[model samples]
Target: MTWWPEARDELARLWVEDTSRQQIAEAADEIDRVLAVDPEARGEPGPEGFRRLTIRPLTVQFAVEEPDRMVIVVTVRLLTD
Candidate 1:
């Protein structure tokens, strides 16, 4: 399976910082699943970019750049509506 070292490390660092490891792990799993199914699922115009994934109540974004892949996650702080 294709793996992203930076992404994995980022998640690990988040866990180290007392972030929800379970949540991050779950998200990573989901991301892996999607990528496995279709590496080009979130295909962007350039070699790297952010692709929003459906992960209820939270906004999960992944940035994939060659030689330095990474995933940036932004969670919803509050519900406006």
Candidate 2:
């Protein structure tokens, strides 16, 4: 399982500031699970489409571009609502 440098750094920072780091870690693990199940699961199509996988209150938006064999995570954030 590989992550882009930016995503890695963002997650690291999230862990640093968020008191619920463990929860976020679990959410990340769930994202891995979704990836394992469907590497091609790009979320709802749109102008800026990405695979939207959620672990409870957190939302992970990403896209799987096969040619490069990369999971492009556009954003990882906690859902306020």
- Model 1 ranges with Cα > 4 A deviation: 43-81
The positional error of residue 40 in candidate 1, measured at the CA in angstroms, is 1.1
Question: Which pairs clash in model 1?
Answer: none
Judge candidate 1 at residue 32 and give its lDDT: 61
Whole-model Cα lDDT per candidate? 0.47, 0.69
> Candidate 2 on 9-45: residue-level lDDT in tens?
7777887888888988888887777676556643455
Report the Cα lDDT for candidate 1: 0.47
Name the runs in model 2 displaced over 4 angstroms. none
Worst 10 residues of 1 by lDDT: 72-81
lDDT of 1 by residue, 37-63 (tens): 444455333323556565422234455
Indicate which candidate wins on lDDT. Answer: 2
Compute the lDDT of residue 28 as modeled in candidate 1. Answer: 60
Q: After superposition, how far is residue 36 of candidate 1 from its true place, in Å?
A: 0.3
